[model samples]
Target: MNHGETAYGLWSLVALNSTVFILFAFSFFKPATARDWRSFGAFSAFIVALFVEMYGFPLTIYLMSGWLATRFPGLDLLTHDSGHLWSTLLGETGDPHFGVLHIASYVFLGYGFYLLSSAWHVLYHAQRQHSLATTGPYARVRHPQYLAFVLILLGFLLQWPTLLTLLMFPVLLVMYRRLAITEEKNMHKQFGETYDAYAQSIPRFIPRLGKARLTADAEPKK
Candidate 1:
């Protein structure tokens, strides 16, 4: 470790970070179904793998030692900052954690958690009522929760760029997509035309921004 980077020989920090993130995510998700468990379990595994390499060990750094040393000589490959692969690859000067991408990563993380919480609330009530979820976050995007997870994962990747996380990212994305399709099939079977119309009106991943705002006078008199 160097002045620009923190030391990563501590085992406690690694365990703490991994536990905090995994537990925090589990709290918000409250996953129950087999599919949900698989998704949540996979997400937890990714998080664990990420922190493991980031603090406890540096497998990717070790694996790519030859190439990294050849490409950028005098690199502090063992430094925690060097684990930020984007900074090294881009030859970004100054602290990698303070770079634009790192700052933007925080934005993605915040928005993703926000979306996850909000979407979960709406989905919970809709599921309880056995009705279509077409309000709140659901009004703008069909799969806001999954998109939220994707954003969160992307944020982590941007900040850390570990090989394990990078590989897990695409796999989780495909899983989420398939899960969304299965969810849609169930919704279509239940709501039929109503769900079809709602699905058609709303985008799957991208939001419609402000188009979902309700007009105060649009509702019929009680």
Candidate 2:
């Protein structure tokens, strides 16, 4: 299989690949708003583009054919292994797909999704009864779900860096930041001083330890 050449990706492969990843992410995210959908949609696009290159069409390989060929004349560009950008760029040999970084990427992605789902579970329950989500993953960070999504994307970038996705990522980060601010505003208004105090105690995305270890929430002692 030529790296930059055409490859046949069966419809079943596409469906299975898309479904597996999307469903995995959906189970964690459980998106509830238009903004959420938009964010998920963008992430989905990145995933699609990634898999499209992985199985369907090697657009990135094709697009960068000249530069890559010039850079690494030894590469076949026909073998699928050439598509492993990280390996080729870093000069790592052997099976790039099964490399340490690749394996670690999956771990980060799986953990991120798990965090998103667990955090969402706590948050959903809290929002239902109009209480602060101060248990489980929420006990440490405010927006674990959002942070999870970011981690998931970071994992993908580590595994496969694409120009389009690279451009979209920072923009999405900014957008997520704005969304987090808006969500916090609503929480502040709804919960009043309780949320303010909680916000002060806990970090938004990064949990603090050492001097930053918080004494859990007023409702949930952890």
Candidate 3:
């Protein structure tokens, strides 16, 4: 297929892409509680909105068309590559997919999904046994699931930056933070000192640098 072709208006692609990603996340998360579903729902909305603009419509490009045309006069606004705003804005000349930011986005996305899946595994078993989750990614951060969502969102932002998604990013961050706080409150009530000790050691969103990793046996037992 011609690489420069306008590929928008493909709603099937939007649906397919959204379904695949949502299902992938759902399978990993297996959200059982209302709060879990709410978090997943918001993430689903973000994914759908992203894919809609990416494949179904080009609202961001259209909104910036005038400025983009004026700034990069020779650019073909209808071409798919033009939608890669970062490359255009950064004055990169090769295929946008092969650009540094795109490659880095893959890394972020891959690692984010891996973290999500790993955290879910630990959390699932913990929930089944009615214990605190302090293994895998949870050992590094108190809210690995929230951190995973943020990482995935960041990966997408690095790849395709739409105005709507960009605006939604901070809103989602704040929402996740609130949800994390609520989750912590519930955990504290349930596990008491165990949860408190875990929270004290691990950071909320970011992990500490150069900390020695704890073995499974060394982690707090439920």
> How do all models score by TM-score?
0.89, 0.87, 0.94
What TM-score does structure 2 among the candidates reach? 0.87
lDDT of 2 by residue, 102-212 (tens): 888899898898898899889888878778887788778888888998898889887877777778789879878888898899888987777887788788988887544
Ranking of models by lDDT: 3, 1, 2
Q: Record all residue pairs in model 3 with backbone atoms less than 3 Å apart, i.e. clashing.
A: none
What value does the lDDT take at residue 10 in candidate 1?
A: 68
Model 1 C-alpha lDDT per residue in residues 68-166, reported as the tens digit of each score: 989998888878888889988998999888999999999999999998999989888878877777788887888988898899899999898888888
Off by over 4 Å in 1: 1-6, 208-222
- Tens-digit lDDT track of model 3 for 1-222: 224678799999999999999999899988888998999999999999999989989999999988988999878877878888999999999899999999999998999999999999999898889888887888888888889889999999999999999999999999999999999999999988777777777889999996735544336664
| Better structure of 2 and 3 per lDDT | 3
Task: State each model's CA lDDT, in order.
Answer: 0.84, 0.79, 0.89
Best by lDDT: 3
Q: Candidate 2's error at 87, in angstroms?
A: 0.7
For residue 127, what is the lDDT in candidate 1?
A: 81
Which 10 consecutive residues of model 3 have the lowest summed lDDT?
Answer: 212-221
